[model samples]
Target: MTGIVTLTAAGAIDATYRVGALRRGTFTRAERYTREVSGKGVNVSAALAAGGADTAAVVVLGADDVRFARGGLTAPLLRIVEVPGSTRVNTSIIDAEGATTKVNAPTPPLSPEAWDATLSALRDELGTRPQPWLVISGSLPELAGTGTPVDLAAVRAAAREHGARVAVDTSGGALDALLADPTGIDLLTPNAEELSAAVGRPLRTLGDVVTAAREIVARGVTTVLASLGADGLVVVTADRAVFARAQAPSVANTAGAGDAALAGFLLGLTRGPAATAAGADPLAVAAASAAEWGAHAVAHASTIVAGPPHGIRALVETSPDLDRVLTAEGEA
Candidate 1:
């Protein structure tokens, strides 16, 4: 793939509030507030575009907000799919310690017809670029008439037709569906908890995580990038696994670190090949870049990369310590 094209099945207007330590059941006033048109795919696309990568996002927007979506997120990077409903507003409360408390609204339902239209739009966008990575992020809303989850297979089919590799970032039943039939998906990004649930086991140590990711690789997925908040990232392929991490200078917000990491990894892929640490394996290079970008994301208050990326270094291990115990704080 030469560039990236993201599809956000569920999009939102993210409202973030900065406040002191939250007092439960009391009126906690916010010290600052910021709003942005966001979704997991939108966040990825934003970060990639900021890094000067060719990227576009196909977002499902409520008809009421479609008119204003371009004003917030640039029109060039976004392809809007309007459906009948009001856009959901997701709220985030960041405490003084940089801890985030998020309240995500219920996903707006989409009819099968609307979903078909959305997929058609995504396919059309993919055609615009010769070869692009199709990144599907965010939760999949159910069909209004059927009450069944959105069909991810259709998305894979669309990607296959355009010769695009698919990368998925989602959980719950959606994750189950992806795992049940890992046909066209090339990359899967899951946090520690999601990986544990995928293998139906508890991942107490790095070894457990690696072992679990291998199972996914065996199933058909080309690579699994597991996010371990503080512990950094673990990338597992069929033959090898590598771990990468970087210390964050500060933690201002962690809402979109994973998305930023994904963007960084994809950017590395778009730049031909990278050979920094542990030889010139694309996976290692991408993992190291992912760690560095994720660390930088937490240092900013916005959900997406804001400006010029500062210099940051990452430690990549070709042979990671499998027995290392995972800490409670490493949850992502």
Candidate 2:
């Protein structure tokens, strides 16, 4: 089955430490730890593949692939493109209160040829097996020869040629390119801070988020899923907006929660039409699933999303936790 294809520009070994209390200027011993082959796009692929979604992960790594290979980080398909430096280790300190502090190492700059090879590999994948979603994720590596970033426009254009909808989960310079022209992206996932940075304003209220998302709609982008951390997520489309929340049983690791949300939303979209409409737009049902999947992710000690959430669709479609936002004051 043709399914989601994710490209992670900067992939890493996620090293997450669970600590009792994170104190400033003191040594905090980790109570437990876990590691996985992860990047935003990789995490999405892992979630989808774990749930039996036919998925592929395109990742850029250094020559050494053994680190990622050793951890049983098996997805349906994994495409690795060698770059200049070693795979960075992203460390996260998860305190008992669910607060997380992450230290992400910078990926070494890639040569021009490396970028070309990466893009070419993705284009070939798009042509060989077309899928509904082509996800371009994570931050851009610094270009060695010049400051010109990786050509996301080229990537999106390639996906369009193969008749695949594009979904992007990137920020900083990478997102700035989309804000300039978001013509073909079907879904854009960004947290509150990333959205605020993209629009050059603070999204303090639901009204502010709605307004910002609408502006992107004006640019021809189809959907926006803005994660509000513990407050849940706000999903905006051309027709309407909705807010959905799912309280976690226990918050163990908050690192990959947003990736889980994006994966769930996309998975729900492919799960077929809802038996009954819960709100104005069908995207609301997907958003509800996104919220629930995110909650399940945080309840686990692992940063990589696990198996299929069998009852997520039924629960989200029937539960009272999801609400369509008619007015700006809509907060779930």
Candidate 3:
């Protein structure tokens, strides 16, 4: 239960410009900021490490842009694979009120050799050590080809070969392809829209989500965690189904909420009795923990202004009232 590996994108930064105030068509003032390492995988890894898990992040970083992405990482193991080309930087602008406008730079594609090397590294890591649970999340770099999902499937195969489980948190074509032939995924975590898109239908209620989850599980997934934002989460397994609700907090930023949920749920799954017991309703427990953790993570993350990225220190410090809501009846 201790070994866990997360595969993701990585890069250094360039510069971000924030423009405030707009009169007619021109900006009144513009502010420039230096770049930093930012991506979905890094954020999820940070959350996992903050939650006291022995987590390692495997990502590709630009040759020169190393400090920005690798800096501030306190994870027990942070492995960076050097790649050519400067990493991408994204820009954002907000008016005096709070309206935001963002422009994102393009991410370079990983070379075929780089991709092969990454998979090889993953295989070697899993092969040598204890069976490490794999969390494959985030979008592939734009340049990485259409075979990204297939490549991920190969990674899943290797993990399974070594007696590990995988949680896939991605969308679009990759997700569709994976669902078409889900062979190694233990958990599928997607939001409502992504779930609807994957199932090729509209999901408007908890019942629709449950139906969709049943269909996906029928295809091949062992479990489904469909996040419904304010409506909370709906979790479905082969033998049990449950929905965990939370009182919504004031949301400042929604960037890493799902990542937080994934980390929290996985934390529960790996550490708690959820995985070992037959017909155990760990999904309800995991979903509750995920919702509570996500709400608090978003609250704390939104408070940080341009300084260092907010770690999970605050979220870890605060405990949500999960016990009051997740009684035996809730799961039943």
Q: Candidate 3: what lDDT?
A: 0.64
The 0-to-1 C-alpha lDDT of every candidate, in the order given, reads 0.87, 0.77, 0.64
For residue 41, model 3's alpha carbon misses the true position, in angstroms, by: 2.1
In terms of lDDT, the poorest run of 10 residues in model 3 is 313-322
User: 217 in model 2: Cα distance from truth in Å?
Assistant: 0.9
* Per-residue lDDT of candidate 3, residues 1-332 (tens digit): 56667777534342334445646676456654434455555556666776676677676777777665556443235567778767676554544433445566755777767877777767766665576778787766643665343356567778878897888888777687788888778898988888888878877566777778889999889989877766667678776666665553544445556777777777767666744465544555576667666765555323112222233221221222323222221232
By TM-score, is 1 or 2 better?
1
The alpha-carbon deviation from the true structure for residue 234 of candidate 2, after best TM-score superposition, in angstroms, is 1.7
Model 3 clashes, total count: 0
Better by lDDT, candidate 3 or 2: 2
Worst 10 residues of 2 by lDDT: 320-329
Best-fitting candidate, measured by lDDT?
1
Over all chains combined, what TM-score does candidate 3 have?
Answer: 0.78
Task: Assess every candidate by TM-score.
Answer: 0.95, 0.88, 0.78
| Number of clashes recorded per candidate | 0, 0, 0
Per-residue alpha-carbon lDDT of model 1 for 223-294, expressed as tens digits?
999998898899998888899999888989889899999998887766534354436877777888889889
CA shift of 92, model 2, Å? 0.3
Selected candidate, larger TM-score, 2 vs 3? 2
